[model samples]
Target chain A: MVGPVFTWIAEHPKVFWTAAQQHLVLSAAALGLALALALPLAVVLLRWRRAAATAIALVNVLRTIPSLALLVVMLPILGTGFQPALVALTLYGLPAILINAYTALSEVDADIVEAATGQGLSRAQIVRRIQVPLALPVIFAGIRTAAVQIVSAATLAAFIGGGGLGELITAGMGTLDIPQLVVGGLAVAALAILTELAFGLAERRLNRTRHA
Target chain B: MNWTLANYDRLFTALAEHVGLVATALAISLAIALPLGVVSARRPWAYAGVMAVTGVLYTIPALALFALLIPFMGLGTAPAVTALVLYSLLILVRNVATGLREIPHEILEAADGMGYGAWRRLVRIELPLALPVIVAGIRITVVTQISVATVAAYISAGGLGDIIFQGITQDFGEKVVAGAVVTAALAVVADESLRVLERRLRAAQSERA
Candidate 1:
C-alpha cells in the first residue's frame, strides 16, 4: 500500500485550503442567489395559487437539465468563468427551495390566518409577520437541501474553468494524481456532510429557542 | 450553427447510450433498495441508518463519485453506472420505506385476521398499496439519472453529453443545443410517463379500497 496522501497535503497546504475555500464560496453564492430569487417567487405565487402547479413544473424541468449540460450551455453564452458557473448552479439550485417555500407558506395554519384577520392585521402584515416566521423552519430545510446539493454540483464548475475543489479533482484526472483526486473527493464529500450537520444543529437550536 | 445530417447519427447513438445507462442503473437500484426498504420499514433504527448512509452517498458530487469509482472499475460504463446507482438509492430507499410504513394499520390487521403470513401479506396487500409512492421515487431516480448519465461522458461512458462536450470543444452551438434539448426532453418524458403510472397505481388501490 502506498502511504501518505499526506505528502501531497503537507507539501501544498495552501493549495488544498484554497480549493476548499473556493468550493464553499461557490456553494454559498449559488444557494444564496437561489434563495433570493426563489423566496419572492414563492411568496408571489402564494397569491397566484392558480398558477403554482404550472410554475413549479417549469422549475422542476429546469432543474432536470444536467448540471454539466447546463455548465456547457453557459460556456457559449457566459464564456467559461465564475459568472456562467454561478448562473447554472443557481438555476440548478432553484427548484427545491422554491417548491418547499411555496408549500410551507400554503400550509400555514388556517386558524392562525383567521385569528390574524380577526385582529385587524392586514393581509400583508399577517403574511410578513405571522406566516413568514412559521414558514422559516420548512424554508430552512429547503435551503439546507439546496446548500448541500450545490456544494457537490459546484465541483462541475472546474470543468468549465471556474475555481473550486473540483480544480483538484480535474487536475488529478489530467495527471494521474491518485492522491490529489482522492483528497479532492474526500474534501468535497466532507464539506457536504459538515454543511448538512451544521444546518441540522442550527435548525434544532432555532426550534428549541422558539419553543422555549 | 447549421442543422446537418452529418451529426444526426452521432446524436441518436448518444441518446441510446444515455437511455441504456440510465435504465441499467435504475433497474439495479430497484433490486437493491426495494428489499432494504421493506426491512427498514419494520425497524426505525434500520430506517434511520439507511437514510444516513444513502443521504451521504447522494451528496457526493457525481463527477467525483465517478472518478473515485474509476480507480477500481477503470472507467467506461462500470464506474459511471455504479455512481448513478449509488445516487439513486437515497430517493428510492426513502420513498420505498415511507410507502411501506405509511400503509394503513387497519389494512394490516385485516390481512392478519385473514391468516396472511408475512410474505403473503407483503406480496398481496402491502406491495400493491405501496406502488404509488414507490413509483414516485422511481420517477425521481429516472429523471435524476438522465441528468447524471450525461456527465458519464467525462468518464468515457458515452452519452448525449458527447455532443455537448464535442460542441463545447469544437464551438458548434447547434450540437450543444441539440444535446441539451434532448436531455431535458428525456427527463420530462420519463417524469410524466411515470407520473401517469403513479396515478394509475393510486387509482387501482383506491378502487380496491
Candidate 2:
C-alpha cells in the first residue's frame, strides 16, 4: 500500500499538486465566504435577543445537511465543479462560526462592558476595543473548527466532479487499488492535521497578543 | 405547485426514516465508544494510544471513510454504521477521559476513605459525576453523525438522502429541498433534546455536589 502511494505521488506529482491546490482553494473559499456572512449575522443576532434563538436554530439546521447531500442538492442550482462545492462547504461551515461568534460576543463579561461604558467609551468603541478582542479566542476556535471540517468535507467535492484527492480514493476504489486508496486517505488526513496545526499556532499567537 | 396533505405525509415519512437512521447510528456509536472509552480511561497508556488513534480517525473525510469501507462492508448501513462509529470515537473518548479526570481528587479520596473499592468508586461515584460531560460528548457525536449519516445515501443506505440523491438524479428541486428540510429538522430536534438532557443532568449533579 505504501509502495504504490509513493509511486503514484512520484509518477503523478503534477496531478497530485493540482488536486491539492484545488482542494485548498475550495476549502478556503468556502470558509472565507462563510466567515464573511457568519460574522455580521452573528453580531446582528447577538444584538437582537429576540432573533438569537431563531438565527441559531436556522444555522443549526443548515449545519445538519450532510456535505455529500448538500453538494448534490446544490449541483442542480449551481451546477457542478467549484460552485456547488463552495456552496455546500459554505453552508456546512456556517453554524460553527456563527454560533461561536454569537456566543463569544455574548459571553463577554457584562461587568467589563459596563465598566468600559462608564469610562466614556462609545458603544462602537466598546465593541471594537473590548468585546471583539475579548471574544477573539473563542471566535477563532470556531473558525479553527470550521476550517478543519471544511478541509475534510472538501474531499467530497470530487464526487460531483469538483475534483480533489477524493478522485484518487474514488478511482482507487474503482480498481481495488488499496495503495492508492491509502495514499488518498493519508493525504487527506495529513492535510487536515496540517491545517489544524497551522490554525492552532495562529490561535496561540492570538492568545499571546491578547494577554500582552 | 400543488401543496397537499399527501405532500405533508411524504415529508413526515421521510423525516421518520432519516431520524431512524440517525438514531441507529448514534446508538451503535454509543455502544462501541462508551466501553472503549471507559476501559481506556482506566489505563493511562491505553487511553493515550486510543486517543491518538481516534484523533487521527476523526480527521478522515466522511465520504472517503465510507468509500474506503465499501471494499469490506460493500456499502449500505453496515459501512455507514462503521464509519459513523469510527468518526465518533475521538469525541467520545476524549470527553469521557476529561470527565473522569475532572472528578475531584477529594471526592475520590472520600470514596476511598469510606471503604469503597475501585469498582465501587468507579461505578457509584465516578460514573455518575462523569455523566454530564460524557453526555455532552454524546450530544456532539449524535448531532455530527446525524448530519454526516446523510452521506450514507450514496452507498444505498436509504434515508432522507434517498430523496436528495433522487432529486439530483432526476433534476427535481422539491425532493432535494424536502430531503434537506427533514434532515435539518431531525438534527435540530435531536440536538436540542440531548442538550436539554445534558443540562438537566448537570443541574442535578451540581445540586448534589
Candidate 3:
C-alpha cells in the first residue's frame, strides 16, 4: 500500500505538492482568522466580568458543533467550497484559543501588573509589554492546539467540494484504493507531527528569548 | 418548522444515546488508562514508548481514523468506541505519568526505606497522590470525546449527531441547532461534573497527605 503511494508521489510530484499547498492554505487561513478574532474576544471577555460566562458559553456551543455539520450549516448561508469550510474551521478553533488566551492573560501575576501600573505604564503598554509577553507560552499552546485541529479538520473540506488531500481519501474510500487512502492518511498524519514539532520548537525558542 | 412533541421526544432520546456512548467510552478509557499508566510509570523506557505511541495516535484526525477503521470494524458502535479509546490514551497517559512523576522523590524514597514493596508503594502512596491529576486528564478527555463522538454519526453510530447529520442532508436549520445545543449542554455538564470530581479528589489527597 505504501509502495504504490510513494511511486505515485514520485511520478506526480506536482499534484501531491499542489494538494499539500491547498491543505496548508486552508489550515493557515482558518487558524489565522481564529487567532485574530479570539484574542480580542478573550481580552474583552476577561475585562467584562459579567460577560465572561456568556462569552464562554457561546464558544462552548461553537466548539461542540461537529465540524462536518458546521460545514453543512454554513453551506446554506455562505455557499460551499473553501469559504464555508474556513468559516466552520475558524469557529471551531475560536473557543480553545479564546479560553486559553483568557486564562493566560488573567493568570498573569497581579503584582507584576500592579508594579507596571505603578511605573506609569499606560494600560495598553502594560498589556502589550507585560501581559502579552507573560501570556505568550499559554497562548502559543492554544494556537498549537488550534493549528493541529484546523489542519486535521481541513480534510473534511473535501466533503464540501473544497479541494485538499481529503479529496484523495474520499475518492479512495469510494473505490477501495488502499494506496490512495493510506497515502492521504499518512500524509495528514505526517503533517500533523511536523506541525507539532515546529510549534514545540518555536515555543522553546520563545521561552528562551523571554527568559534572556 | 413547527415544534412538535414527537420531535421533542426524539431529541431527548438522541441526547440520551449520545451521553450513553460518551459515558461508556470514558469508563473503558479510565479502566485501561489507570492500570497502564501505573505500570508504565514504574518502567521508564516503557513509559516513554507508551507516551510516544499514544501521542502519535492522538494526532490522527478523527474523520480519517474513523474512515480507516470502517473496513476492519465495520461502521457502528464498535469502531466509534475503539477510536474514542485510542484518542483518550494520549491525554490520560500523559496526565497519569505527570502526576506520578510529580510525587516528591523523598516520599518515594521514604516508602522504600520503610520496606514498603513496589506494589504497596504504588497502591497506597503513588496512586492516591496521582488521582487528582489523573481525574483532571479524564475530565479533559471526556469533554473532548463528547465533542468528537458526534462525528461518529457519520458512520451510522446513532446519537445527537443523527440530528445534525439529518439536518445536513435535509438542509434543516432547526435540526442542526437542536443537535448543536444538546451537544454543547452535554459538554458543559460533563466538564463541570468532572471538575467537581477533580476538586474532591484533590481535597481527599491533601487530607491524606
DockQ of each: 0.63, 0.45, 0.36
| Model 2 spans with C-alpha error above 4 angstroms | A171-181, B1-28, B39-48, B70-78, B104-114, B156-158, B170-172, B203-209
- The TM-scores, chain A only, for the candidates as listed are 0.94, 0.94, 0.93
The lowest-lDDT stretch of 10 consecutive residues in candidate 2 chain B is B1-10
Q: Which one is best on TM-score?
A: 1
Summarize candidate 2's per-residue lDDT along A3-87 as a digit string, tens digits.
Answer: 7779989988987888888898899899999999999888777679988998887777677656666676666577777788888
**Tens-digit lDDT string for candidate 1 (B24-134):** 998999999999999999899999999989988987778778767766787798888898999999999999989998999999999999999999999998987888999
The better-scoring model by lDDT among 1 and 3 is: 1
Candidate 1 falls in which docking quality class?
A: medium
Report chain B TM per candidate: 0.95, 0.91, 0.90
- What are the lDDT scores of the predictions, listed in order? 0.86, 0.82, 0.82
In the range B79-181, model 2's lDDT, one tens digit per residue, is 8878878888899888887899888899999999999999889889998999999999988888778767787777777777777777766777667766776
How do the residues B57-170 of candidate 3 rate in per-residue lDDT, one tens digit apiece?
Answer: 898887778767765787789999898899999899888988998999999999999999998998898888888999899888987788668888877788888887787668
How does model 1 score on DockQ? 0.63
Higher DockQ: candidate 1 or 3? 1
Alpha carbon RMSD to native, model 1: 1.9
i-RMS, each model, one decimal: 1.6, 2.5, 2.8
